[model samples]
Target: MLEIRPSCERCDKDLDPLSDGAMICTYECTWCRDCAEVLGSCPNCGGEMVQRPIPSAARLAQDPPSTVRVFNPDLMAPTSD
Candidate 1:
């Protein structure tokens, strides 16, 4: 299951699970749409952002999943040409 994060690692913006601005890489590295596009991609793995799946309230009510926080804030460095 995806560990839908709570915030963007770059801008520290809130990333609600149901927000359309939310995006994530294969590693579940979360980021906002702006940062993802401006940065040209995920700096950690150079992967592109894709729509994140939100668990239904019914499912969440039954068994809540774990939330993830950014651990490697420096993993993504500014990309230069």
Candidate 2:
């Protein structure tokens, strides 16, 4: 199951499980669209960036969003591959 992670790993921006702004990699590394595009991949693992599924409100409440957040505020997306 996807943790639907709590925030962007690059920007530390909130990415609610149901937020349309959410993007992720195959490993479920979450980020906001802006960060995801800037990174061009998951910085931690280098997986392709893609849109993440948004859970329904009821489902979200049942599963609850993850409290743990992952980010390196000092890290910036690489400019080149």
Candidate 3:
């Protein structure tokens, strides 16, 4: 099951599970559309960035989104290779 993370890992922006602004990598690293555009890929794993699936309101009600926020300042820096 997808963690459906609650915020953008890069900018710390609130990302509702139902919002289309959220992007994710295969490893489930979450980011907002803006940050994802700037990055063009996942910094941690070098994986492609894609849109995150939006869960239905009913499904979201049953399985709440993760409240845990992963903010890494180092991740914001540009990486080589």
Candidate 4:
């Protein structure tokens, strides 16, 4: 089951489980659509990006969305050797 993570790992944007702005990778690392697209893939795992599910109200109540927040500033940093 998806954890429906609370915010974008890049921009720290809040993404409600029912909102269409959420996207996730195979590792369940969450991001907003804009960041997901710009990041291109999960920087921490290099996994494909996909639309996150919008759980029904009952499902949400039973498992409530995760409040955990994740951020990876390196994703937006320029690479250097």
Top candidate, metric lDDT: 3
Question: On lDDT, who's better, 2 or 3?
Answer: 3
Could you report the Cα RMSD, in angstroms, for every candidate shown?
2.3, 1.7, 1.7, 2.1
lDDT tens digits, residues 1-81, model 4?
A: 678899999888888889988999888999999988777777878899999989999999998988989877766675444
Error of 2 at 16 (Å): 2.1
Whichever of 1 and 2 has more lDDT, that candidate is 2
Better by TM-score, candidate 4 or 3: 3
lDDT of 1 by residue, 25-75 (tens): 888888888878877777788887787777787766775645666755563
**TM-scores for candidates 1 onward, in order:** 0.77, 0.85, 0.89, 0.88
Ranking by TM-score: 3, 4, 2, 1
lDDT of 4 at 76: 66
Give residue 26's error in model 4 in angstroms: 0.6
Worst 10 residues of 4 by lDDT: 72-81
Best by TM-score: 3
Q: After superposition, how far is residue 52 of candidate 1 from its true place, in Å?
A: 1.2
Least accurate stretch of 10 residues (summed lDDT) in model 2? 72-81
Model 3 residue pairs with clashes: none
TM-score, cand. 2: 0.85
Q: Rank the candidates by lDDT, best first.
A: 3, 4, 2, 1
The count of residue-pair clashes in candidate 1 stands at 0
Model 3, 1-81: lDDT tens digits are 689988899889999888999999999999999999988888889999999998888888888889999877676777566
